[model samples]
Target: MLHYSRTCGTFTGMKANGTDVRPWLAALVIGVTGIAFGACDRRGADDEQVAAVEVAASWRSIAEGVRGDRIRRDAEMLADDAMAGREAGTEGFDLAASFVAERFAALGLAPLSDGSYLQEVELFWTRLLPESARITLQAGDTEIDLTIREDFVRSGGFGPGEERVDAEVVFAGHGIAAPEYEHDDFAGIDPAGVILVVLSGAPPHFETDLRAYYSSSTVKQTEAASRGALGLLVVRTPVDQRRRPWDRYLPGVGRTDMEWVDSGGVPFGGYPELAGSAVLSQGAAERLFELAGRDLSELFVHHGAGETGSFPLGVSAVLERSSDQGRTVSANVVGILAGDDPRLRDEYVVYTAHLDHLGTLDDGDDQIHNGFYDNAVGVATLLEVARAMTKLPVPPRRSILFVALTAEEKGLLGSSFFAQNPPVPIERIVANLNIDMPFLGFPIGDVEAFGVEHSTLRSSVEKAAHAAGIVLSPDSMPERVRFVRSDQFSFVQRGIPALNLKPGSISTDDSFDGPAMLADFLDNHYHRSSDAGDQPFSESGAERFARTALLTGLWVASDKDRPSWNEGDFFGEKFATGRVAPVSAP
Candidate 1:
């Protein structure tokens, strides 16, 4: 007979003779004892507490398989200079893909239908020539010439050509058309044959997920194209400028853009109807407003005051740009851990971490933009989590698919492609757990999960966080619109319940400034050469995150019921296939 007790907040096993066992030994003993007792009825809270302790002990034992040293080793190798930043479609990216495939194979994970771990992704690449791009604004007799990459940058998602558009300009407030919200930016104006200049983000009063959807460039451009607009111009307001300064975009002036293609070779996200499009700097936008004798600041104030107004700017812009476009093939490294239970083996719980980053800069002291924290760490965590899963005494009821996706830095293309063209039946895929750039330099006491509010996955996330002895906090920077920024959004777009977990600002060590560390990485090292793997890292933090994610996936896979979206949820109603009334959240 065995008993359990807590000493100094650590569970320990007590023998019938009243002897205390070491924590590790206690966990092993309790795990075996609980398995032997098997299915016991939950008579009361005492049984619940006992069951919880047993789960925590088992999870802790499994988590030990995810070693900090191994994670660091893998991350350093992936972010090595030889990988050339692992940009998709490049040889460097292929090397990184091979590395992940090799790791997956070593763990005894099975490959996809191709009989190999690599799943080829077809992509259409477009690199805009900033030097050749031209933009000129005409206001009566005055013609204002704007410099490329300074005043504006041509937007991607357009086909290759000397594309040009010269037409009258219209100021469309927010450029969103949501009938549910009773909002339409083009209520009074006809978008036909006109260039629509719109604000960058949606209204602040909108719900979080709704705001993210309306604020995205793809949605805005799609709205413009559907309305027969000749072109589109996105301008950020003072609020948006403060959050993400325009100058930050200068470093990526001429970055290559890409979109995944279909079987017929047609690009997935190209909007050919809008012949021209560009993102304007605040200064250029101010100049345009000045030319129209209107205060852009006043318009911003009106927008903040909940006034959605549209008007003709009484000005016109001539936009032209050329791009070097072609087709290339990248691969998403996929490996599956087949479930043991015949009842749920067909259903899968997917784990994704992007394996691509910015390749290299043409003119820079350190050309390699090693994405050490941006995603090398993410892929490392994925590998470690997969390894930990394999160490479980009993496999999850549902199959687990560990996918190292490519081209996430290129606008979530790889995940998007996979969501569209899944390895198994799409409906059988239950949930997505994404890891991207988790804080690895501090003692993490808590974690923030994006996109957990709208689905039943929240319960499992909370349980996992509790089992890992960490707090699950709300998103720290909601203004950043992170819910739609990562690979998880690709799965969310297909109505799959998904969440992206990252270490929160709260730190276990009071002496350390966690927020400052996060801010420094975002401002100084993000997308820069300084993001090298050699930088100091906290292995404990990595281990904690991996454990939390591992437990979350395990809980979801073992549950008898499939995860579902919250009732009347925005994303669920909009994207879920065969849209039905969703089950309410627990």
Candidate 2:
């Protein structure tokens, strides 16, 4: 049997009793499984290189089976006006779900959960009572009353009681405490019985995935609550303002928030200790910093340089809010292409794309936020990947599951629910490949595979990128913390290796600037009513992305061994706790 090496996140030759068996194990793997191990002999290691090349060669034909025309058709349908943006729990979303289910049926795939294709998910919807909300800061003898929608915005309450907090405020830097990176914002400061004033993102020097983990608002709030902080006030930095304009958030000031509910009706991801929270505008943040004997600009400079220190703001803040909480239901469309191999058929490789968008707004001139590039293209790409996988000459060794999830726009609720209550046994899942808003502004010459840095799936992704004639590039905007923003994060939290690919800055045509086009899309069209189906779309780019994603999934599914987290990985050490079968071999 092939052994997983934690040292390098790869398969090697070793017995279960920790004996070295590389010589015979390598031969057995190649002869019986036709799968290549990443290890090599001394010197040039020519044999391992040849094995990788052969694998890439075999994947080329299968990758080419992805069709641009099919992807275009699916995207047009999903982004059509009649779908009303495919928001979860609406009739429009139901129509979109029906269409996806019909397409899966036509593709000859089996329903993944209970032979029904639709896995029902319950959601708790909470809307803030703007009329009842108030926020103010008191510094010694001065009092500053902040205006809602202009100065700050609050989140919906997690419980029925009216949320209220009256506590002293502390400038807790980025509000991060990661010992692995030797950074702690609460090192000498006492966080008990206070509200924390934190910056929006994480330090710039940390690696991509680690930065993403720390930059998450949920993680920051958890850290705060665990330290006995009563509330939080997140300050918008100038860097974040430049990346995402503040006006964009004005439309969502009083928007409803959603969380997936468990069997006991308790909402997931609730921080009860944190009584209230608010995000401050740049101007409001500057005012608060001025009240303390500090300047926001100086603090930003120190933060950019990865310097860590926290000081009490010597300001007390009062925040009060209430919400109307209710329940709604949505569904995840799941289908499976069973593997031909009997021994590995039960183990699964999952592919996911969110099927929901922002839905229609009440005040916009054009109400429908047709999310064509935000996720319509992503779901379309997932369908085409499924089609291409079906057209392969032989089935992959492990079952391939395709999931079109809902409520991703609402904090990845659908995926969170599915990962927690999987149709199959949780330990049977081997890996996850998720597709979100992969920008197709220009013909993509390179791609960025997030989360590959932490898992053994990197080898398969490299081979897939080579087979598809695409270069693999590093994350260009780690400050956005995208690795934790998508549905793949849900699977990653469950100890599954996951990947989310985005188009790289490289453009095939010298006349076009891919990075500029992507920036334009984000600034003008992202999550706006302008993200309609009529926008210019590159079918060729979608097809390229489909090929890369399909080949990557196939590579992992065909291997005899399962993907493993890197040795001493942050995610693995924290969440990889369970009794899981090591290999798919019998």
Residue 396 of model 2: what lDDT?
83
Model 1 C-alpha lDDT per residue in residues 511-582, reported as the tens digit of each score: 667788888888778778988986668877777678778878987887778899888888888888583333
> Could you estimate the TM-score for every candidate?
0.90, 0.87
Clashing pairs in 1: none
RMSD score of candidate 1 (Å): 6.4
Q: Which parts of model 1 are misplaced by more than 4 Å?
A: 1-58, 155-157, 362-364, 577-586
Q: How many Å off is the CA of 20 in candidate 1?
A: 25
Steric clash pairs (candidate 2) = none
User: When superposed on Cα atoms, how far off is each prediction in RMSD?
Assistant: 6.4, 7.8
Tens digit per residue, CA lDDT, model 2, 97-205: 8888888888888986467889998888887888778888888899999888888888687776587789999989999998888999998899999999999888888
- Candidate topping TM-score: 1
Task: Name the 10 consecutive residues with the lowest summed lDDT in model 1.
Answer: 1-10
- Error of model 2, residue 283, in angstroms: 1.5
